[model samples]
Target: MTERESPFIDRTGKSLERPQDQWPPYVIPKEAIDLEIERLADLPAPNNGRRESFIAHPRAKEPGLGLAPGIRVSLSVLKPGERTKSFRHTATEVNFCIQGGGYTEVGGKRIDFKQYDVWNHPSYHVYSHVNDTDELQVRLCYSDAALLEMMGIYIADEDPPSVKEEERDYADEKNRTDPRAKNPFGTFQLTDDGAWLMPYETLINPETVESKAHHWPWEQVKEHLDKLSALGKDYVGRRLYLLYNPMTGRTNGTTPNFFATMTCRPEGIVDRPHRHTSAAMNYYFSGRGQSTVEGEIVEWKAGDLMLSAPGWAIHNHAAKEGTVYELTIQDQPLNIAMESLLWQEDLKLPAAILGSEAGFGTNR
Candidate 1:
């Protein structure tokens, strides 16, 4: 018989004061992305019909290679008249169209998107991308797959089967009427301090909220964002709108793991220096800008993607010319749900544990 080694490590009297090593801000220039897209377009279609490449940070390690610690960004290209095989994964995703137009079939719904459009994919929902146009279609897909991969539980199925509509309806009805699905004793308060005792049935059969795919067309969002410039130069808050998904509830996200916001910055406008525990990545689609991250200056222009804010790193952005349009994605919802979202809207003020504490507000 083989003997197993002990899994315990003795840390007696050892100091537990290890400081976190934050990753440095990185940028993928527009030229590089364009070159890659062209290269992808020239390659023969794979068996799966998915031509994709991950944008990884230099500091990232294997098993979870991502531009940020918790966020994975991938550049995917589909040639004209091409489509990908059906796929489903346990990780949720935010999909942003960068070039051309295409449609996605996800969870039995078809969402047609154009350039600069934003959409989300719910976890475990079978999806496929199709490029029915005459031009090559490109997208930037952001996901929490890095975090899941780090936890060693990232799951993906190729060509997954679709759930039959009648079977799904029948199963829902059965679960609704099953006696074992209900807890007779119910969850009751056990102490004055808010502790409660829950039965096994209740623990296993929690309320289910339908997670759906949502689309945010750029033309529609742009009209509303353009109005933010009317707020003038005195506005303290960011000129952005979050692409919200109702299923996330109080977490305020487009998906369970991340929040996607479209920001419109007028010429010469600068953002205040601030820091947050959640990392941020931005894709600029219009005009030019410069971001100061941890005292380092990084300039960007239209079609550039950057890791503007590494976790807890001080950062600020300024528009250089024209109206700058950018799409920013952050793993803020996951942090809030974990009670670890620390945000400092103003450098002069102390950081707040956002979600649990009152958040900072801006004047108009």
Candidate 2:
């Protein structure tokens, strides 16, 4: 009987054997891995520290679902001579030209954006988009009530107000004219001296944020983590860049609010039981591992999102050879505003820190 048909005596006479090496064949330096972690930790948030802006055409496609909460991704299509109304808004927004071309008019200035180009708009900016493309498409990423509420900056206008030209004038007067502005998002005044809002810094621009090495620079990635580490309050592990931070005008770098990080566990690696004060979510990027979230052993994989509420629990991570998901938070804003932040880095140390091992495992 063929191996497939034979229950015993070797279907096809094949035998399976476990390889001596469980991890991937690739070699990875601990220092290099630590540097990568630092890079992610040092990523900078948006600010007048850099000039950031974009002009998306009217005809754009919808941006797909993202990991952030309370955000909606969508696309728009604009035809020639089709102009959008100019309005003042306070919600953060980003857009990328997917297939078409278009121009946006802000403060009576026209900026053009084409496919693969990204644009960032800060909160409380007066702007509008128009489609002047013969055949262009656009996609945009933006947040709704969910994001606003998280930052404690939500505003509700239950009633629509009549058009006011004077209000438009005030917005137009605040328009930025400096070509050297460094922020990718539109600039906003924090003080009379000119403090630019940088809510888009963490979302690095391919054309901007120079990095000479193979990996992203430390400041370009790890600044977010550093910010969280600085906050000495109920801080726990985290996942980052889920959304834009209004205060810094950046993606997921350092926020005056929340933070996160993904952990990596090579095959056969196990992070012994440990606990912390901050609640967190683990977004598995790859590999196979089991995390004892609270008490239950949770098997994980790529794209899987796990949660860990605040306080200590018997949590451990194990994998034959793969990367583990990681996310932690101390609720920066909640602690800062309430003046109740605290942290203990050395406390409840896990036996194996993520990225401690050097090697790879199964490709998956």
Candidate 3:
């Protein structure tokens, strides 16, 4: 094969061969992502009247990235004073606010939201994003659209009965055990003993049952916020807030398939590389920075979305002069619950990268 031929494609044989290295962990640099999204902002909405909906199709012509099975990450960019016409879909969606603030109407109800607010849209729930802010509004949204599409059940439209409402219920495994019960709110699951999560079926005391919500407002959970700096300089520090579920004391995500997190990389800090099975859909919330994924340097600025797909590469994060705030939605929580979350860190680096052997770890 020529040098320009794709590593993922096997032109030598009649059958296709997908080499792992060819699709090695990669990044959707913020620049290209923002460029596409900004371009979408200026265009007219489809007949559905969604002002601008941006989804990074994982299977692009170039070497694309998809962090996990059954997951699709997208961005919804709305200009000032714009609102989307009501539409519905069969895919469950979790949304993270990246820039500006707005309100959304879900199932005929109004939800006022702001930056860092994590929200959800249940399957078949009629919803619309209403951005009244003077500035452009950007959001990182993810869903199991790929899975639904594969099953031939995915539907998105403003029309009626593309799918039966009952079919939607069967598609949603919110309770996992109860197929008929509708999840009017957020859900939880237990993973480990004395961990943030516990299995739901094993609990003995009904009175002691804990529950987590579908949405977590940044202002409300500010006190529970933990910073990576709290670990001292000994740890390659980054500041992040976890959305926890009060129910199982485990991860608080909109759905069981995935969860979200917010991290703040201090100015000039370079975090070490780590490899894991969970894919992370990353958003550059603020400031400027870069991530080295599979030896590819992906530079990004504020409002950029980068996807670090699972099993692809070792990912290291770094920030420029200013602190970089980031939002990451990943399948880590689900892996932890299944007791199969495998990960490793490469902390030992050259003296030049670590500054000094003594500077590598804190004095703790």
Candidate 4:
């Protein structure tokens, strides 16, 4: 095909077979490929101080590494005996330990960390990290840029204060020393020899967070909600509670992680259709509602689930006469990591529409 006359049209409206390497021929859009290529091309060549050519963000700055809207990712390296000063961020974080070992203090609790360990920091919480190992160390950080932007927050830090002599308290070490101290709050049930998570379970035990600074299992949380509803105290006008499970932020450090939250709206409530940075699945329980998923009017009843992936169009829900409930789970870490969240409001709710594409997740 000639450069101007071709059968295939790319996102940039260029001929597919052009020799200029505008895009990957069969994969991503030519415009997207051009964007990526342009990004890579903008990087300065490696030099003495910057040994790593692909060092995206060398500085630990706030809103540090912006890839796109609503996402921020940063990777850092620490040489032996080199460590970061105590710092805090307005962004919640999920971090993966790529190499070496170190010590981390979150909310005044010190935990020894090693390769493959994951760590999470709640939004705006002060935390510190140190590397005492003899080898180079690295970490991958993911944060929600959109949420932070909405809240008008950023990461800030001060130089590490000189150490002072104070008696360290090992009182919180009871769970570490005792074998019978497992799951004092029934957070992670002993499914086998080790603890396994159930989809609907919640971490009700306050000690779980106190000990590990992380919350897992949502079943117990659900039971807590059940009791509140039984007492007629619905979950409305309450702070949006979250079960933060960072994929690489867990102690065990696994990927493809899951995080979910329960949201309820009393009668005559409507949440406008919007898109987010990640693919999400909403499990509706114990309520009736009308959900418009990507232009399809989906009447959601109890036991129904709705799913929407990135760029899958708009989605929103409206409650019936009584309260409406739903649990939304998403790969938020990835979204926050990649920064591709989108939303729209100010327009009236679209008229009820219908389509044959209405369906729920298979696991629903």
Q: Each candidate: what lDDT?
A: 0.92, 0.40, 0.63, 0.47
lDDT of 2 at 138: 41
Candidate 4 residue lDDT tens string, 1-364: 4576787756796556743211110111224323443453344432311112111222224433332233344445555665455666556655545457777676676767676445566654556666688875565454564345545765444543333423345764664566565544544566677876643223432323322345332345556555655554443333233555443343112122234555555667776555433445444555776766556676655544344332234566678856665555455544333433332332353321111123121110
Compared with the true structure, the alpha-carbon lDDT of candidate 4 equals 0.47
User: Arrange candidates by lDDT, highest first: which order?
Assistant: 1, 3, 4, 2
Clashes of each: 0, 81, 10, 9
lDDT of 3 by residue, 1-364 (tens): 5576555855674756565552444456667766866887888755555544445444532222223455677667888888877677777677777678988877656677788788777666777888888888877778877656667777887754422352535533465556344344334544555334333443431354422225777666443444455566666534676554444235345455566677767778787676665667677767987778877887777766666544436778778857676667776655556655555554353322111112223211
**After superposition, which runs of candidate 2 have C-alpha atoms over 4 Å from their true positions?**
1-153, 156-253, 260-263, 272-277, 309-316, 325-330, 333-338, 344-364
Residue ranges of candidate 3 with Cα displaced over 4 Å: 1-34, 57-69, 79-81, 155-157, 160-213, 218-238, 245-252, 336-340, 345-364
Q: Which residue segments of model 4 deviate by more than 4 Å?
A: 1-65, 145-147, 155-212, 215-364
After TM-score superposition, the amount by which residue 221's alpha carbon in candidate 1 deviates from its true location, in angstroms, is: 0.2
